[model samples]
Target: AQPQEGEIIGGKEVVPHSRPYMAYLKIKVKDRSGSKPSSCGGFLIRPDAVLSAAHCVLKVTVILGAHNINVQEWSQQRIHVTDWVIHPNYSSASLQNDIALLKLRSRARINENVTFISIPRSNEHVRVGTRCRVAGWGDTSVYGSTTDVMMEVDLKVQNETLCQQEFHDYQRLSMICVGDQNSGKSTYEGDSGGPLVCNKKAHGIVSYGPSGRLLPLVFTRVSYFVPWIRQQLRRFALQELPASPSSQ
Candidate 1:
């Protein structure tokens, strides 16, 4: 069966301010030669840090705290990415380790609308049939345009073995497959880098999907990268630490 190519297949509109940690990332090309204004979804991990798929870390500007793509509200926060770090092992070919951390130029104000989301522990496991929620501002259906407002859908975790049957190269250890084989509800192109939240914790990062097939969507397992995330944070903190007087 031909998979639908829409961003968010069969999703409902997310209520404004409901998912505050959800981030709408805008990619502004330098010369405007490529795609005019490409966009992706992500989630706030810290006041100045955002977690998203490595593919979303293009050389462009990123905007956070956005609700409606068409309207700018006080709750919205825009930050030019000072820098970003993609997983060292990230593969553009196979999309392995498709995770990245975006550093903001300045700390984002934490208010009613913008906050960070908790990540699952390294040992946490999301079993098959577990219901999770994913929200993004991507195409509502195949061959449809991206939506102005954010949308969300509920999806269930699928068994890794079953997912492997579908994708020949699926890495079960570091990736998660989500969707209902029967319902065909799945994420699409513009929804890349969005978080898959289960039990109020981010368990996966939307990675890729079968291009024209709505079978199941793939995500980078957040639990597998939890240690890496802590390492990055600790490394950054050390780099920012002041030099000791004795050393000076």
Candidate 2:
């Protein structure tokens, strides 16, 4: 499926650089005309790894430690993606297993501004009605202007029954239903591939939403793919290592 871009709707500007784990994705997609510029959100998981939605992957430049994307902030660390691993079972139609890991060409500079976000344990679960936060630098409304600074909104996790009603094809294990339907708060275009943070741990990734920027957007659950994440991260590290020197 052609997934829509995303952003934070009805959100407030977070304290500058407060979310240390936040990653700004500058994507360039080549087409018939030429390469077009676009954006997405991701989070640092390791010194050289960023987690995001698979569909958002393209020719990506990962920016860390930036509040306003338009500015040349000193805290920013821009790096190109050398490699990436998308879930093998990701289904475009259903948006299942939308997670991806981007391997940076070099390790991120760890400091006061840039850091990694924790992930939920393999068996951990976020209860329904739990309030969580999602952030991005996308538009504030449908066809609205994109913001300069990063924005975030607090949304409550909805029950599976309600989620099933909104989305007939909801996947209980791999996907999650988030956002408040009545509050007018949501993730809009430019926000896809961002992290859904709960209790400071990454729980979901922005995947897809309805055409109208409808409520109860779907996210790729993180906990369900913990094993895959670990495996990929380790494999990438292994590949980056130089081959063992010949023994005497």
* Highest lDDT model number: 2
Report the alpha-carbon TM-score of model 1 versus the true structure.
Answer: 0.91
Q: Write the per-residue lDDT of candidate 2 for residues 1-248, one digit (tens) a residue.
A: 12222336777889998899999999998888988999999999988999999988989999999999999999999999999988998877877789899999999999889999999988588988899999898777776767888999898888877778777668888888887776778887788988999988999999877666468788889999998988888788678665743221
What is the C-alpha lDDT profile of model 1 across 110-173, one tens digit per residue? 9888899999989688999999999998877776656788888899999898779877779988
Q: What residue pairs are clashing in model 1?
A: 3-212, 3-213, 3-214, 6-142
TM-score against native, each model: 0.91, 0.92
**Off by more than 4 A, model 2:** 1-7, 242-248
